[model samples]
Each structure stands twice: as structure tokens, then as C-alpha cells.
Target: MTRVRVGCVHLLIAVSTVWVTQAQMGFVFPPVRIQAFSPRGIRVSVPDVEGITALLFDGNINKRIMYDKGDIHGFVTTKTNDYWVLDDPTVELHSGDVINYNVLLETGRFENSPILNGHFKSQQRHVVFNLERRSPPDSSLTVAESKNIKCNQSVTVVFNNNTPICSGQIIFEEDFGTLKEDVWQIEQYIPTEDPAYPFVSYQRSAVSVANMALHIAAKLQQTEPGFTSSSLYTFTLDLTDGCTGKMCKKQPSGADILPPVISGRITSKNFAFKYGTVIVRAKMPKGDWLYPEILLQPLIRNYGDTNYASGIINIASARGNEYLVANSKDYGRHVLYAGPIMDLKCREQLLQNKILVNKSWADNFHEYSLRWTPQYLTFSVDKEDWIHIEPGARGLVSRFPDNCTDLPRERLASSSELAPFDDLFHISLGLAVGGSTEFKDDLTTKADWPKPWRNSARKAMLNFWKDIDAWYPTWKQPELLIDYIKVIAL
Candidate 1:
């Protein structure tokens, strides 16, 4: 009788356990299916659901969520007494098959965030639902809208006739990554010394591309009695040895003479643009007697008897005596000159303007740009327009006397028609030292200069050269860091 009672008790316990399991099975929820995905967020659909009591989701989608002060937690929980908010959010859902919400958490607390387990209790059931996040499509990967386009990238410009101008895209760009030989031609030819200021020379070995930026440095070269600096020149393939064919070689000399200064220059002679915007980000070199120029040389050297204008867009002229006088107010040491030059023989400047910045140009990187159009040419520093030249502005004529016989017919007729600049032009970037005629004249007349330096500008340069070792260590730091040079057709 006792054994039979024990068997009956065991059977009753087993039956109760099965009944509890069956009741729990009725409360299970369906899995959440991913419908779509995007960079902004994801979409999901839940099936066979009536009313929801609690819904939880992972809020940390795009970025990591950290529990720190001032850190944004992009989630919130309502009905504070019923729901325990995890690091994620506990969402309360009404009866719906499809629900949409942003993946980003806009506002919430970061302290004691809860983990997402996809477990929730409904009005009629205790449920465990499977949630999935889909990956975004490949078409979603794209850059944001920018005014400046990358090299070789196409930009559509709509004309008045509704025709799209996409063919004249980015013509050239130099990021200084292992210098492309086909696009750039490094200059090796020696330049003739200017009679007014004859002191420095150009060298071929001074140009180099490293650390993803073009470095043009000036260093003292040991010479016979005095120290001189070398300079680098890019572009001007015509100035080089052979101009017979596309494949030209730079002239090599067996001369053992060492120049006092060594620098670097690079030019884009092969790539010329008619009307476009040219932008260059560069850091100027420090010290006295340094002239860093970003200019456009005309493709056609001469358009008649007169020499064609080489657009002097941006020039950081010598910070020596000329700058000292011009920039009397301690705004900046560097003197900025920008505009066009029509005749090289007379050296007349048309639409040129001078500006003084508030900081040393070598202290940080700044962008210098020139936007050339058929109507006008505008020059800017870091996108701030300091000089604007329209067609018929005063002093636009190439000749000053107004009765000069050598003035070009097109230029003489109307100053609005910008000659020499209308033709295609190539870009030139170079660093020159200690031979500016303007600076030389200032040193000769200025009484503010030091004793021996007041009369002789060359003597002051020599003094700086004597301490070259103390100034120039290597061509690495504080170089003319050319981040990039980009050209886009207007």
C-alpha cells in the first residue's frame, strides 16, 4: 500500500511539470526580421504580434557608448516603475506589425546602461524575440558635398543653354605622393642673374617629395669665400635643355661649383588651363630674404613684340627691408602681392594689390587661390578675397604713358579685355632667396637697419649666411609643406 502511494505522488508531480511547460510555450514571441538598412539607420518588421508591454533595442549602433559625464546616451525609458532601462532603451510598442525608429540615440543617461537581450513581456505573453540588423548597401558609401573636387574627378556645370560642362573637369592635382613624372617636370636649368639683384642660384638637387608633401627648402652651400643658398624650380621645360620633342632631358653640367643656397621648385608646364580656379595650400619658409611665389606662366611666351603677362597670383615677397617698411604696423612680417603683369620688359603691374596678414606665414598652413574667369580674376587667402580685378578697372593698361607704341592692340583698346591672361597658362611654385631688387632698394635708404646693414643689403645677407649652420639644420621641419595643388575648370 505504501509503495503504490509513492508511485501515485511521482505521477502527479510529473503531470504538473508538463502542464507548466505547455503554459509557458503559449507565451513565446516571434523573431524580428530586417527589412532594410541604411547609413542613417535600420528597419525591422515584427510578425504575429498583438499588443506589446515592453520592447528593448541596442542603442549603440554607429558608435561606442561609454558611461561618462557629458557623453550622450541615445535612448530613454518610459513608465519608470515598470521598465529597467539598460545601456540600451526599453521601447514600449503598441499593436503593429511594422515599426520604424532612428538607430541613433539622441538623448539619454550613460550611467548603468543595460544590455540588449531581445526579451520582453507582452500583455498576454512573456516572450523572447530574435532581432537582426542588416548591412547597408554599397551605394550608401559616398563623400559629403564639398566645393573643392579631388583630382581627375568630374563636376557638372550647367550652362545657360542647359548644356552640362563635365568634360573640362579637374585637369591636374599634385598630392606629392612619389611625384608623377608625366604630369610634373622638375627644373634643372640655371637662370640668368638679374642685374638689379644678383646673388643666388637655382639647383636641381633641392627638390623632393616626402611625408605626403612637397618640400622646397633653402640651405647654405659652402663656396669659396662666402656661403650661398640654392633654389628649386618646377615647370619651365622650355628653360631646360631640349625642347625638340615631348621627351626632353635636363642639361647636365660637370661644373664643380657649389651655390650658396639650395632650394626646390616644381611646375606644371604640360598641363595648362584657360579659365579655371587654382588652389594651393602651403606653409612659407622662415628667416629673412625668402621669396616664395605661386604664379601662372603664360603658355605663349610672347603674344607680339611685347612679352606676354605671367599671372602673379600669390607671392610671399621678401620679409627683409621692403616688408619692414610696407608693414609698419606689426600685422605680419610677410608681404602678400597678387595680380597680373602684362609686360615683362617694363615690369608694369596691372590689377595688383598688396596685403598684410596678422601672423607669420611660416607658422601654419594657409591656402592661396586664384579664380580666373572671362570677366574678372579674384585672389584670396584661405577663401577670403583680398583682391578682385575686373576687366576695365583703372591702371589696367599695360603701358603707363598711354601713348606707348608697343602696347598690344587688344589691351590698348579695352582694359576690360584681359590679354595674356586669356590664353592657357601653367603653374609654377618656387622658393628664392636674397636677390629682390625691391628689398635691396629699401636696405639702401632705410636708416632703421643695423649699422653695416643700413648701406649694404648684400652685407646683411652675408651675415645671415655666416650663421647658416645655426639656422638651417635639415630640410625636414618647417618646410614649404604643400598639402595639395588642385585645378578645376570654371
Candidate 2:
């Protein structure tokens, strides 16, 4: 063991073990895993870089890898929790360099990335490593050739496929080229008890991707493994494996029953952005009371107190019904809606958020776009203008109903004009059937086809299930088809 000085801290290097103590997570640095992605570029993946900042090579090279956003390549996206950081392997170690001191470690959230919570602060501790100087691959070799021959994970030597992909503006993109769990998290939750009170519960089997496009289809609940037509109403169902909804469980009563439909939802919970433009190509389903949720919901509810306080930007929303008439008006697929959902009443959301067309959206696929910035937001369908929302000088409060009130006015006062929207938001896709708040109770023509259930009725699910013959047969296309989704940072 040898003692050395780094900046102001004293460090002890265990020459034999080559170990460094990470006190925050209680991890002892042992045998660092190193890899070469390029001819000269090398990276080290540490299990947890909690309060650490940059890793140093021979005390001469310093590169910030823990929280790097300068270059897209620097921000390595990984499925594992280990932190992968690019180290400048191009620089060679000189004589008398302290091999044990590999980390230029810094502690405290204030000195680290802003995303971290500033609840703890610590002075730099003794972190040291001992290593024999290992040279990088010869700089003369081409990247492709270097990847195949020198690669340790044996198979066919392929030029480093682990290299970062940097395209302009695009931050998160999915062609459904195999649903990546690190990106699109397939939901395994159910809304059975106090569920959104929707007639459907999310199941994995209902979601699939074919021909490079994702399809979220709705199926009969009885088709699930252990469920049956009569058993659905008999046994109490709980989606406890990954229930994102309510935990309360209640036995099926006379009118109250299980979710009669099986549907699914997926979210990009692993990734989020502050301001970005999103484009989605999708075809709406042709069925009664089916609603497609293509939305960007807030990652943090920094504004108001309620669940939807941070706001939700609806990329595109269209009903499945093609010919449902309401009060001499057609509220079917002929109508498309897009807007920022601020509150549940959100008169601004309900009244002014709709766009009309002569043709039904379910007839063909449509390109839905959202251009969100710090100032204004524009929603478009098929590249045509749908709604352009640029709030007044005071912000969105002016557009909302008076009763909406100063919903946590204190926070909004100090925020940008796009308070709720300016914060980070992620993408979500799902299909829902027959919900209370979505459909108005008074209107919605079920008379012609015999609307079985009232939106406000306590026995709404039972009523809809009893008259399945009427609506189920009308489900010409019960799948919410998503061709592709892309999010580009502004």
C-alpha cells in the first residue's frame, strides 16, 4: 500500500488488490472492466457512479462520463444499471504515474449533475486504483477491422456495433424494430379495482409489433389464460405482478364486474426530454367507444397538486365509431382532437381542442405531429395544420376556465411561459374502452345502435357486456395501429 496526494485529499493505493472504496453505495473497486469501442477510444463501466463525476487516467486525462450530454455518443444508452464512460485511451501513461489513482472523484450533488437531488454533500474521500499501463489498439487499424479482431466478446469480429448513434435533433426514435425494453417499457398493469373504471385491463398478449409497426389490439377478457366468459364475473381478479392502478380488491357484485376487455399500454419511461417535436404515424381503430391514447405526459408534476397538473399533450385522439351521431352532429372518427390537457374540467381542452374532417381517420393511416417549444405548441395531422396554441404573456392560465384557479400559482409564477410543458415529458401509447370522464353522459348517440350503458351509470360495464352482440359485431377494426414514433429535440 502506498499513500499519495490528489488535489487536497490523501489516498491509499492497495497495489496488490487495485481496489478503491465507493462509500456512498458501499462498493469496492475490484478488477475494472475495460473495452475498446474505436481504434483508440476506450470506456470503463463501473457499477455505480453515484456521486462521482469524472474518471482520470494517470492524473493527466480527465473526461466527464457520469453525466455527459455534450455529445450523443457520450451519453451511452444501456440496459444495465452500470455506468459506461468513455476514457481517452489515446494518451499513454508516463513513468512514476500513480496507477492506483484512476478516479478523479468528486462528491456532493451540488457539484454534480443538476438532475441529482441536492440533499447530501460530502468532501472528496480517498479513492485510488493500481493498474499496469495497458496500451490501446494500434491507431493505424480501421474501426471496422479493429472491432472484429481485437473484440473480447467472441463471435464474428464486427466493427464496434456499440458505438454511439448521433443523428440531428432526434433524441428518441422507435420503428418498432423489436420493442426495446430499455426504451419502450411494456406495461403489465390492470385497472380492475377502481381501475380508470374503463372496461379494459392491460395485458401483455394484447400488444405486438408486426411489419415494423406496433399494434395494440383489444381482445375479449375471457380469452386470457385463466379467465372465461362466466369466470370473469365469478372470481376476483388482481393484477398484482405490476399493477400501476389501485390496490383495493372487491368481489364481483350483481352489476359491478371485472374488466370485460383486455387491452395494453406501453411507455417510454426510461427516456424523457424537456422540449421536443414528436411525430407519429397511426391508424385509428373502427369500433364503438374505443379511444386511442397517443400522448406526451409530464415526467414531473412540478406545477399543480393533482395527478394531471403537469399537463398532457395529446398527439392525436379519435374515436373508433365511424357513424355515431350526437345531437345532429357526428362525434365519430370524422373528428380528431389534439391539445394540452391541463385539468379534468379543462373547458379549454374539451371545447377548443377538436378538429373536423369529412373523411374518417380509421379509413387510413394519418401522420400526427406535435411541435412543442418553450413558447408555443402546434398540433398537426398529416402535415396539415390542426391547432396552434401560443399562450398569452401571462401563460396558459389565461386560456383555462376561471374556476380552474391558481393551481399552485406559486410554482407557475417563477417558471417559463411554458411552465408545465417546459419540464421533462415521456411518450405513452395505449387503447382504452368506455370511460366515464372521456365520454359525455348526456350526448353520444347510442339510440340508433341501442347504446347499452350510460357513462354515469354504476352498472356501466355490466350493461355494455350484456349487450355485447350489438357493439362487438360493430368492431370492424379493434386494433389501434401505430406505424412508427419519433421524438426530436428542439
Best by TM-score: 2
lDDT of prediction 1: 0.44
The residue-by-residue lDDT of candidate 2 on 1-490, one tens digit each, is 4443433334343422321222223232222344433223444443334444433222223222221121112222231333334454553433332222233233332334322211111111111233333343422333443343332321111111222222223445566635666457777665543213678878777889886579999989787778888966797876666655554243677777887888888988556666657889999988888889898877766775463567778788888876676577667777887788766655235334454567788888988998887788888887887688887667765566567753555566577777677777788899989876566564454657646678678888898788787778878899888977866545
> What's the CA error at residue 262 for candidate 1, in Å?
2.8
The per-model lDDT (C-alpha) reads 0.44, 0.60
TM-score of 2: 0.63
Task: Please give, for residues 99-169, the per-residue lDDT of candidate 1 as tens digits.
Answer: 32212111222246422222231111111133323333221211321111222322322111122223334
Off by over 4 Å in 1: 1-168, 193-198, 223-259, 304-312, 315-323, 326-332, 344-348, 351-358, 393-395, 398-416, 436-440, 444-447, 450-479
Worst 10 residues of 1 by lDDT: 1-10
Q: How many clashing residue pairs, candidate 2?
A: 4
Task: List runs of model 2 lying over 4 Å from the truth.
Answer: 1-168, 192-196, 242-250, 304-307, 347-358, 405-410, 444-447
